[model samples]
Target: MSFRNFTTGQSHGFGGTYLKLVPGEMLVYSDVFDDPNLPGEMTVTVRLTAVSVGTEMTVVQENVPDVIPVEACYLGWQDSLRKLAGLVEPEITG
Candidate 1:
């Protein structure tokens, strides 16, 4: 997937194939950055579980390159998940 930093006008992308998929239950994929500086293949796993209120999601990433800081990666995941929730969750109006 490709992404751009609106604030900095920097853009980059990664592409990978799905290693495993269990529709609505789990997903496993590998990613390789387009930038040569960030050289490494990263594996990502996502799990979903139904809950009382909604679905719970868990994400785990492995083989992240040493160039990227862990905190930045975490914050990026948080931001992405927040945006995802905004898109998937229903809006309530009083």
Candidate 2:
């Protein structure tokens, strides 16, 4: 098992998009395995807690094995965003 802290955000109309991952909490780092009968991709889950607001977000990343080449790693990123969106809440700031 491994952990990583990844944060990403996007705003409409020139607000800009931010995406970054600090590898301080890497939970799993193993050498690439090459086997004839093994899974193609590995799923990684990471949970981050906001220091100031006590908010939590879960980030899921899929490590696509080079052995099994696919189209693109799109679904994995989308799953991460969907998990974070579930924990979003509105706050009053003045």
User: How accurate locally, in lDDT, is each candidate?
Assistant: 0.93, 0.46
lDDT of 2 at 54: 64
Model 1 Cα lDDT, one tens digit per residue, 1-94? 8988788998789999999999999999999999998898999999999999988989999999998889978888999989998999999999
**What would the TM-scores of all predictions be?**
0.86, 0.27
For model 2, name the residue pairs that clash: 2-27, 2-28, 3-27
Under the 3 Å rule for N, CA and C atoms, how many clashes does model 2 have?
A: 3
Candidate 2, superposed: residue stretches over 4 Å from native: 1-63, 67-72, 91-94
Residue pair clashes in candidate 1 = none
**Over 4 Å off, model 1:** none
Q: Per-residue lDDT of 5-74 in model 2, one digit per residue for the tens?
A: 3453522111111234456433432222334343443555555666686646565546656643454345
